[model samples]
Target chain A: MFLREFWHKLGSPKWFYQISTGWMIGFAVAALVLLVVGMVWGLAFAPADYQQGNSFRIIYVHVPTAMVAQSVYISMGVAGIVLFVWRMKLADVAIAACLPVGMMLTALALFSGGVWGRPTWGTWWEWDGRTVSTLVLLFLYIGIYALREAIPDITLRGRASALVAIVGTINIPIIKYSVDWWHTLHQPGSFSLTEKPTMPVEMWAPLLVMVLGMYCFAGYIILARMRIEILLREQRTQWVRGLVA
Target chain B: MILRLFFSELRLLSRNKAQVLNPLAFLFLGVMLFSVGVPSTVQSNGIYAGAVLWFIVLLTNLLALDGLFRRDYDNGVLEQILCASEIPFMVILMRIFVHWLHTGLLITLLAPLLGLALGIEAHALPVVMLALLLGTPALSFIGATGAALTVGFSRGGVLLALLVLPLFLPVLIFGANVINDAVAGIDNTAQLYWLAFISMVAFTIGPFATTVGLKISVQLQ
Candidate 1:
């Protein structure tokens, strides 16, 4: 019964707006503080790698962004499933809001990965497993966004994009596995996600902070977009009119 | 009932001999472009031959998928089937099967000729055909979902490619790998097994998703 009421309240845009405003502010401030501290520590205070020297500092941005990129896609998949099963308007909003954020974050991860690679691998792009998977993730994002644009009807667009997103979710694991296999067979001496990082605690701690900061930042952006979507979708409603007037 | 639907679709599709021949012609031209245009020296290398053949097969599959459901959907045939059948999902599955039969299987049958054009050795020809025979059904199954989603749109050709091509990568990777390994005189059994596994999964999930997409398209119309 309590769960039911919570779900009902969640479906209410007005209630969501009231609750998320505080969340949005809190997360924005938290993300800002954490990112600043983490960056300062990682860039200046963290000890340089014995092998990689200061060039290794990029991982503080690279690894965290890469982690969040995958997480954000998974969250969109969950939202897609929720949209189909419950027909909740908020779930659709979540998917709509996450695509751009996920796309940019994935791009950031790829860019940072490339930067890191230039120092470590002697090249800007290597068709390795993680890099190829991230590239595919970017393409999937483009596909979903394109599908949404092609369909004109709002409800139909929601359902169609939702289905595409869901199918993409199922394909992600297979893609990762196949890319990994292809990479292993094609290039024996290459970076892989399975290798254990030998970095010390001091080196990794700031990365932990950066990852948390990035997640909070992504949440704030997604929620802010959700709020704007709510307003746009509900512009003609009495509650929205009263709030505006 | 399934046979009745299957035969009817087959009969209708066979009447339009051009549609059946279209993908085959595309496959032939695509192989000629690569082998003839790129010069013989590069084409004769069995490894490149294997990759080029699989890539051409993938593109040809995409070409054939454009009409998988558009004609039926446009002519009110799909709508009537949905309204009349107790299980409309079978209609989609059968359609995809017939599509694979015409485009995919025929391509597989003709793959040896393309393989020879690319200078693929005798040992690799069987593997190339085997990979296509196993992997192409999955393409049809997956393509059906994209077709169903975009069937409502008047112009869905490029959009369907965007939506479906990324999903085709794994199939392409495994199928190509199967032949590439064979050309290198390595065991390709593992890749073939993975290709079969993917096809099974696509067969199970494709029809259900396509049915849902078709229903949505029909309802929106």
Candidate 2:
């Protein structure tokens, strides 16, 4: 009675899809608007680092992508807990949609980081904690995606892959802290929910914008993908056929 | 009953000698090839030496781990183990234990020779071996957890690598760090203890997950 009806509606796929559409379009528009803003600011307006010069521009994309890659996995873990606790099938499907986007963002992080590293660290690769651990996060995302696609039975695959995703969640913090704890070239966190960004407002304001923009884009991409995944996986189900027609 | 059944599974593993040795051979051969291939300059630097050694070890670990719980899934042994055994959990548990004893322990025992080839100092051999002894089991166990989670499907062995290796990172970090520190004549006890703690935690908790995973894998199969 106290917190009931709102949460209850989310249990149904139709309720969720209908409800989420508004959020999806809103996020998509917001992401597009901010992506143009962030890129323009980052590529054109943001001042170059005194140390690394133009290469530091990579941070605008790299850090945000890596950060979102991590948050997406954390979201998937929460989805796992949701499904495991409430047996919400839709939550599992939603979690499935998060995997590839997380992976792509991880790839973006790695690519941008690697390019940034060529100038900063003077090496294409290093076993420095943050670099190596972020690389591992990329693998974990691939594993989640592969596990889902590998199994033929959609529902069963969803459950099994969720189990793997939940287990892999243990590594997220390790990746985050590895940069701080270990002797590494990678920089530490900025703009955390609790902690203030280390840089001045000039740097972090744009960073804050990029982070929010990426979150919204991630939302849009995952929702779009989930709609596709549902259509593909549920092609044989009565509801899906009705929707298709 | 599970012990008897588990031995049969081990026998099934050994019966395919290629399965067991191929990966380990890849480990050895890759190390040998890399050692041969790298310019002497890079090989001389301690930094590159350690990175290359760990990289080879990681790759070999992946190769070996690809076999974890795979054949049994193929043979329907996993399904039988799930349904027929009263202590099916123990059956999954016992298989992983035997796997560690066989693969992890053997690789660890061989780490010194590897250390020697990789230009690791003689004094550091002990630390590297100790790290491997504690660390490889963690890899094997976590790998089995991933293997169990992914066993029934096509393309899963490769996917299993992606899934499990990230989980393998902490041990790699500490294991390599401990070795690097020991070589530098620095105290590495903290890293060593952390690696062991991770191994212990995985050992205690991994079986239950593997058990549930086996059930899920088999049922889906």
Highest lDDT model number: 1
Give a tens-digit lDDT track for model 1, residues B65-172: 888888888899889878998888887788899999997899889888888888878878888889989988889988889889988888888888888888888888
* Structural RMSD, model 2: 3.8
State the iRMSD of every prediction, in order shown. 1.0, 1.9
> By DockQ, who's the top model here?
1
Candidate 2's residue-wise lDDT over A140-216, tens digit each?
A: 77777777777777667777777777777755665445434567776766666788777777677777789889999
Candidate 2 per-residue C-alpha lDDT over B139-170 given as tens digits, one digit per residue, 9 for 90 to 100: 77777778788777676766776777778777
Residue B110, model 2, lDDT: 84
Poorly placed runs, candidate 1 (over 4 Å)? A184-197
Q: What docking class should model 2 receive? A: acceptable
Which model scores highest in TM-score? Answer: 1
lDDT of 2 at A37: 94
True-structure Cα RMSD, model 1: 2.5
What local lDDT does model 2 show for residue B184?
90
Residue A2 in model 2: lDDT = 50
